[model samples]
Target: TELQSAQRKAAWADVARRIAHEIKNPLTPIQLSAERLKRKYLKQIDTDPETFATCTDTIVRQVEDIRRMVNEFSDFARMPNPVLAREDLRGLVSAALVLQRTAFPTIIFTAELPEDPVIVQCDGGQIGRALTNLLKNAVEAIEARKGNDLPPGRITTHIVRTEQHTTAHITDNGKGLPVENRDRLTEPYMTTRVKGTGLGLAIVKKIMEDHGGALVLEDAAGEGARASLVFAQGNGRAGA
Candidate 1:
């Protein structure tokens, strides 16, 4: 079954590569045409100016959405192998946290990193990206929880090191994990949310695998989800 799944994913990735290559060529021209049309004729339209503006705006918006999807397809189809090296894992986590905190100022962010650096043999950029994506997902999940009675959104992060593994946990207080098909979230094109290319977790999983590690998804203590990036420690593979 795993073999079948892997084959299916390979086939889909080939299709994605072709689709991205073909679709991206026209998106820029289409967007530019729509913008030009709007800029040149917004006020000259005699019949209904508002309707003309709305139509052009819709065209531009939809084209941008398609461009985003195409980029995701490209990213998924051509994920590069991790460039592993020795680096401070805590610094990577802190960088990711700083980015997410700046992006989502309303969400309270907290970190529990140790005073000393936790060094590991891994791709610092890829690890930072994985952390950033998880943090972004957590923020989006909190934003999606629509209610007047809900408390302020919060995200917690921690980097822990043991004899066997060095792990980073990103926990959020938002919508909890889905009861069904939780494990499938890491599969390519699988998603719980309506928006997104559904490749965030999949890419993260690939990055971890490249480093001989794992990406673990689970529920938080009370609410929301926790994504753990675990790198092997003292195995002549990952940690120092």
Candidate 2:
């Protein structure tokens, strides 16, 4: 059964690679065409310059969005093996929070890291990306509840190390996951946000798997969502 599951995952990875390659081939041309249209027609339409500019701007923006989606697909399809090394997990978490704090000024971000380094053999870049994605999703959830009479948004990151595993918990005081389809949140193209491509969580899951880790989701104690990245403890065992 485990072998079959592995085969299924490999098959899906191959499919993702092929699909991402085919979809990415034409994005460059489309993006260029949109940019050219904006540049060539911005001043040509003298009668209604505002309307012309708005239309071309919309085209450019939408093309950029498509390009971003394509890149995410490519990242998922071509995820590499983690280059493991002993590193400080606290610094990685702090770095991710710093970037998110700049992006979301209104949200209160906090971290609880041990004074002594919690060393883990991991690909720092990939793990950092996962952290950033989790933070981004938390911010988006909070933003989704705008206009409601709610308290200030808060996101907390806490790291726990045990004898057998290390876990990083990211909790947010925002909208929690839906009870019905929560299990499918990491599947591709499953998103609740209008503008989301739904690949963020999927990519994070892949990265965790690549590192012999797991990505877990749950509802926070009172409200909002909590995501955990769990890594197994071993005697310097490298992930395949």
Candidate 3:
């Protein structure tokens, strides 16, 4: 795996370099090609219209996913500076939920917060990325351990305010983490995913620490995991 990973990284680096070199070099009509795929002409044989739709849908969806992966790779190669300012956590989380709803259609994701605004000082873009990664990981974890055709999963976001600190707890009904990996959860280059870069949680941890906060992993109520980001409250912004 290591050797393959190294080779793949080398290949990816070369591709990325070339992408940077050739302005609009990714000129292949991949989307168009997929669109023009052969379709069964026989009306009776193709009576099941659903089959064709599914095939086309899957191809287009996966192609878009690959494009996203490449875009993330590009971003990671040259991460931009954070546009720091006051960010409304509730609104930000809501926006992320909109994005996640598409990827995890069956997973019920909810946000629980006080009516009052819980504003923090940070980069909205970076924080959004952190939230999306955590949500995506939870969804995949749940889907994997869904033993016996279990029903769809759910995630709950609870924002609590204390005298000294604000805590945001994201709880999922996915596979729970081993107690042993708790301490190592945020370690860079550490992960349980086969294709993971092992950097999502690390990036998240950096975000928390960057904002005078800490990202803590804990057990969820019934199942799954809870990643809590604890930060100083009192209406003060993060990184401000």
Ranking by lDDT: 2, 1, 3
TM-score for candidate 1:
0.83
Determine the backbone clash count of candidate 2.
Answer: 0
Residue 83 error for model 3, in Å? Answer: 2.4
- What RMSD value applies to candidate 2? 3.8
* Local distance difference test, each candidate: 0.86, 0.86, 0.73
Regions of model 3 farther than 4 Å from truth: 1-28, 39-65, 149-151, 178-182, 234-240
Top TM-score: which candidate number? 1
Residues 1-240, candidate 3: write the lDDT tens digits.
999997787788677756744532342366556566634332345477668667766777766666655554554543445666887788778888889988778889888978988887778888788788778778877876846877669888888888888887888888887666768877766778765656678778777776777888888877888888777775355444
Compute the lDDT of residue 114 as modeled in candidate 2. Answer: 92
Q: Clashing pairs in model 3?
A: 121-238
Please provide, for model 1 over 81-174, each residue's C-alpha lDDT reduced to its tens digit, 9 standing for 90 to 100.
Answer: 7777788888898889888888889899999999987888888888888898789889988998977989999999998888889999999998
Prediction 2 global C-alpha lDDT? 0.86
